[model samples]
Target: MKNLQPIISVESDAKMSKCRTLIMLISPTLVLAIIPIFLSFIIKKLILMTFLIFFGFSSLAMSASDIYFFIVILLKMRNNELFYQEDNKIYILKK
Candidate 1:
């Protein structure tokens, strides 16, 4: 009897490079998500802390929206789909 399971090594340098790229791309979003918690830990003033928390969350929301737009555009480009706009909405055609 012979072992038939295939093994793939992700420890190769090329695979590590891809892993690093993924971490780099995702770290900003992860850090932004944690900013509110970090602010709470550092700020002791109730009023200023509230403002910082508000702005931090607002910025996170804006960043998330931008990420969504970027993903949509990337998908459209990769799928060879045409994007159109109507009433502030985006429409993509199936290719």
Candidate 2:
């Protein structure tokens, strides 16, 4: 008799490792925070500093929303990659 077996694999986007994806997703907010701090060094005017601070803080809402949608998109794409065959091994698809 001969033994037959299939190989299994997990698939994901090569460019989007979990850490990198999450970090890249959230970096906009981080950049928003950084801008205000940088401004304090170059901008001596307190009024303008205060305005930029508010603008940065307000922009976080938009960035947070974008991140949420991106996470949803990633999850959907990942779910789509989960393909299986009725064999001894499974294969995953990556983008």
Maximum-lDDT candidate: 2
Give the worst 10-residue stretch by lDDT in candidate 2. 4-13
lDDT of 1 by residue, 1-95 (tens): 55433242122222122223335435555576557657866989998788777766765765674456556454444344444444434455544
Clashing pairs in 1: none
- Lowest summed lDDT over 10 consecutive residues: which window, candidate 1? 9-18
- Report the lDDT tens digits of candidate 2 across residue range 1-95: 45543243333434444445556556766687657656756887989888877777776665765478457656754633533324444344564
| Whole-structure CA lDDT of model 2 | 0.58
| Residue 72 displacement (Å), model 1 | 12
Clashes per candidate (backbone, < 3 Å)? 0, 0
Q: What is the clash tally of candidate 2?
A: 0
RMSD list, candidates in order: 16.1, 15.0
